[model samples]
Target: MSRFVDIRIDPAIVRRAARGDARAHEIIYRAFSAPVYSIGLRFTRVPAHAEDLTQETFVEVMRSIGSFRGEAPLGSWIRRIAISKALMLLRSAWQSRGQQLDEGWEDFTPQRGQDGNAAPDATIDLDSALAQLPPVGRTVVWLHDVEGFTHREIAALMGKTESFSKSQLSRAYQRLRPMLQVDEEELADSKTTAGTVLGSC
Candidate 1:
């Protein structure tokens, strides 16, 4: 799961939610919505899909609350559901489109404003950079880097060998390297410009 979620919920709240308490349901929704939506967007890069995933994830959470065994942290379990939902949509996309990799992410690269700071197109965010890779590669990177899923786990999720996960991650990094280099150079330029301005002042 992303660091954006703080997963520490009172177990009593789970009990209440399981008992069909509306307030408890709302509590769980508020706590988990951001991370769920974030995961959706990171995976699909589409606002509508992310919104739908968020809604669907909550519905699943409510329906399954009774069986949640507390063997894992609530957040971890919720994240698993969100990832599964996102993958299902992606799988459908793959089947429909013949695994067409979205090149739209190419529209976004590192751009800077005149103020020597990140411009409207600033591309330092991993999500933006990640858009450069193929869908499976993107999924592998996000799950590993942000969500902390091991390669073996990711491979199982994708129904591939562990080496396939490793290879995708490797390929993703390769594709992202030049963009990251540009980002680094831009940061260096920004700092140098700032220093020059300060010295003149």
Candidate 2:
């Protein structure tokens, strides 16, 4: 009785799941949970939110898998739900908690370690640099670059113009380049300091 499903599924399996086949439901959930949670973590930056998003996505999946209609891959369908849920959470947090999406660069300065030494070299890694971006910038970067969402798709999802998505992604990259790359001026200054110290020795 379920609607036609995706290339990722057998119609009979969808039907059985829709008809209360517990094993079929389990199969679908297990198959899709990793991708769902992956996007959840990238968008929310919290493992707990990712875990919650995964559960919420599968809840909708189980409830509405009958109406899939084979429009795309079932994985894509599940991902759409997860993205919607993640954006909803972001919006809720921004509105209710007054979360700031455009924090100043000074505020994102890498923190010292517990022993008060500099942050580890890992701070220069892609993941850490991505985390330094403000929320809107970070979301656009991950959605467009990591998730392979098109500018048009991202704009539609965020209720903005395509140019907005493009600009946000641009700004995110502008912000990230400095974080991820070494600065020539800083390198030169450090070399100068090293030479002076060596001369003094």
lDDT of 1 by residue, 89-142 (tens): 887887786544332234434444576454444244544556656677778777
Residue pairs with clashing backbones, model 1: none
What are the per-model numbers of colliding residue pairs? 0, 0
TM-score for candidate 2, please give it.
0.75
Q: Backbone clash tally for model 1?
A: 0
List candidate 2 stretches off by more than 4 Å.
1-7, 99-124, 182-201
Residue 64 lDDT in model 1?
95
lDDT of 1 at 86: 89
Model 2 lDDT per residue over 71-155, tens place: 6777778788888888888877776755544433445554456766544563235566667666677787666654557899988
Lowest summed lDDT across 10 adjacent residues in model 2 is found at 192-201
TM-score of each: 0.76, 0.75
